[model samples]
Target: MKTEGGADAAKRRAGERAAEEVEGGFVVGLGTGSTTAHAIEAIGRAVDDGLDVRGIPTSFQSRQLALEAGIPLTTLDAVEGIDLSIDGADQVVDDADAAAFGTLIKGGGAAHAREKFVDAAADRFVVVADPSKLAARLERPVPVEVLPDAHTVVADRVGDLGGEPTLRSAEGKDGPVVTDNGNLVLDCEFGPIDDPETLAARLSRVPGIVEHGIFVDLADTTYVGTDDGVEERQY
Candidate 1:
């Protein structure tokens, strides 16, 4: 859906803030999703401006976008210890309690596994989003990435958690959506996530589950863009 007041403008604001937070010879962790497209664009501009940055994109789509943006690309073999990651979110809550330990919820593009890995590896993860994406509570469903062979198994596990599981499918595509890692994505409809950190921990213990979209306490800070201006929340 097209966002009001121009989503591109919001993305540029958040991307600029994300760029300002990084430094020289940095290994950047990039995220997927439309909003993040703008961040990638900004990263390319940063490269042009002589910022020494190389990116590790979270998804194939993100990688292509990054390459198109003219940002230098590298792999984990080339650079150890990512300096920072900047990504967009479907919903973001910057409460100190929620983001204190680099936790968050992402994966609207079904790239949760890589997003989680990148977040865990980064020293700082900056989530960029428009102000409207903030939530009073994490009431939306969490997306879970699972092995294709374990779809039923994982769905049963999620059901035990009082959630209904449905395989996520792309537009006009049949069957479950497969991630870059060749896993299936299940949308777990848990009405409200009271304790995101706890839920994230619990999901980690589930067998056949590659990664859950509930990013708990991983976000060091969130840069929210609004029509009025941009704001920051430290967690």
Candidate 2:
């Protein structure tokens, strides 16, 4: 495991490596999180160096970062498709039941809903992370965005699926944490997920589930920063 500072440096290195994949005239899907923030900064620098690209940010924070970086912004409706998406993950698991690239547990920032949308819209989805985030098995709880009115119902349904569902709370606010899409988040713990693909499919069927954080089969590749160097894994 890496220390805090080492992990942060690794993240930046991973982001910088992923940024190398970008090209002129590409419509990139910018992801959220600290690792992705490094990518945003690198992309901004590229723009200053005369690279022409448009960014579709996954969150308000990412949008602001892109704006500051001088990267032109566009909406999904304004673009035909995203050339690439660079993002981070809370955990990356090598599960036999997952897609060839494995599975991801995201939404720590509560932007999984939008992140999923933009990621799927992209031609390629790339994950950048530090070595500490990788695991033999995923242990993080899945984040499920739900409509406020369906919170209780969704919790019950998730419980039926053998998950312990807990509503995510705001850090500085009085109530539950609400997503940018106006939905509440349910952090569902199904310890050591055996089949991420099936789990993601099942979660989608829950009536109130707007989007769940089990990013099954979406990642095309992952760039991991380690003490030695950045390693690239293709799914």
Candidate 3:
């Protein structure tokens, strides 16, 4: 599960499977990241194949990509329930011994807020990832999206939690990368998270915090691509 194209391929395959599972004229919630890019590509293929679908993108970049792919765009306000959402994650934990899935941490791209919004508005949420992302215990730095103006305040608050917060940025870009919501992203490195749900709740409650890249138990299923093959997990 080292760095390779297998994860992206797995993501693409999962996206294709999810796209085929969708029904006619359904509203689709799109997510962000490299893996999600594959999902979007698959959705584009579905559209090319004549599937009636409308997409709601979670990020500005994602919106542009979806439009470029010829997927019809729409706002969530106009759509009621999304048929399904295909997204990616920073980490996914599966206790095969316990036969459980859907335990995950997302928001690597600082699109967690919108992704969460879309996930809540969907009938089903599917997470795609590589087997390397899985762990015996889910542990990773949780990302937090904040208002640029609140950077100082949030940083101080993050320190109280024994976490180091760094501003998220893109190469060749000055300042922090602002989200579609006009908020800044902070990569809060708290080390291995003991309780993702609790941490998510705490960070989200902080003022000037627009959103955090932590997703609780929102996924219904997850598809992991491995060198051996693809693995499916359902909550």
Candidate 4:
């Protein structure tokens, strides 16, 4: 167990460890969120030290961060494929078999839709997190990005799937939170998801649902920071 400040430090350690995977001339995917912010900063420092890497940011926030960190930027259309992607996870479930891929629930920052695209395009998708993010089963609400006009319909469909759906609202704004893709997000609570792959597929079939936050069979490895040190788990 760790105190609040210790947890933040652990996350930074995990982020730094993940940054070590970067190599010169590699096209990396920059992910959004607090944990990945540390990785972005580490990568920026490496760039200052002569690490020549181009970044494909997953969101506007990441793009801005990369700019401030002095990391060069590129677009998905400009690259064939990304060498690697390091992102943060809201929840991580490591499979029992090391050969099997693990599950991740993301979109805490409302950027999972773009994050998934960049992550899937990478040769390896690595998750960086603090120990508190690891879970036996995913209990968080899966965020579903839907077309603004389709939010009502999508909410009904999600409810039919045994989830309680709530439109993610902005903290300072009056309306619902809109994603970078100009879509509405539905936070659907499906307690302790047993089969994320199945649920993801089912959600995909729902019309107007652009993407879901349930990342299934995508993560190649996870770097978790603990009181002892950074722990690596390969999926």
Q: Rank the candidates by lDDT, best first.
A: 4, 2, 1, 3
107: Cα error in model 3, Å: 2.2
Worst 10 residues of 1 by lDDT: 94-103
**Residue 79 in model 3: lDDT:** 75
Residue 61 error for model 1, in Å? 1.1
- Estimate candidate 1's alpha-carbon lDDT, on a 0 to 1 scale: 0.81
**Per-residue CA lDDT of candidate 1, range 148-202, in tens?**
8998998998898888999988778777678889988898888877777777778
Candidate RMSDs in order: 3.2, 2.6, 3.1, 2.3
Top lDDT prediction, candidate number: 4
- Evaluation by lDDT, superior candidate among 2 and 4: 4
RMSD of 2: 2.6
For residue 110, model 4's alpha carbon misses the true position, in angstroms, by: 0.7
Q: Flag regions of model 1 displaced more than 4 Å.
A: 1-4, 95-103
- Output the worst ten-in-a-row residue range by lDDT, candidate 2: 93-102
Q: How many backbone clashes does every candidate have?
A: 9, 0, 0, 0
Please provide, for model 4 over 1-235, each residue's C-alpha lDDT reduced to its tens digit, 9 standing for 90 to 100.
6543588888998999999999999999999988999999999999999999999999999999999999999999998889999999999986565222479999999999999999999999999999888887788999999999999999999999999999999999799999999999999999988878888899999998999999988899899887777899887
List per-prediction Cα lDDT, in the order shown.
0.81, 0.91, 0.79, 0.91
Instruction: Kindly list the per-residue Cα lDDT of model 3 for residues 8-71, writing each as its tens digit.
Output: 5666665666555566788889888777777788788789989889999998878988988889
In terms of TM-score, how similar is model 1 to the real structure?
0.91
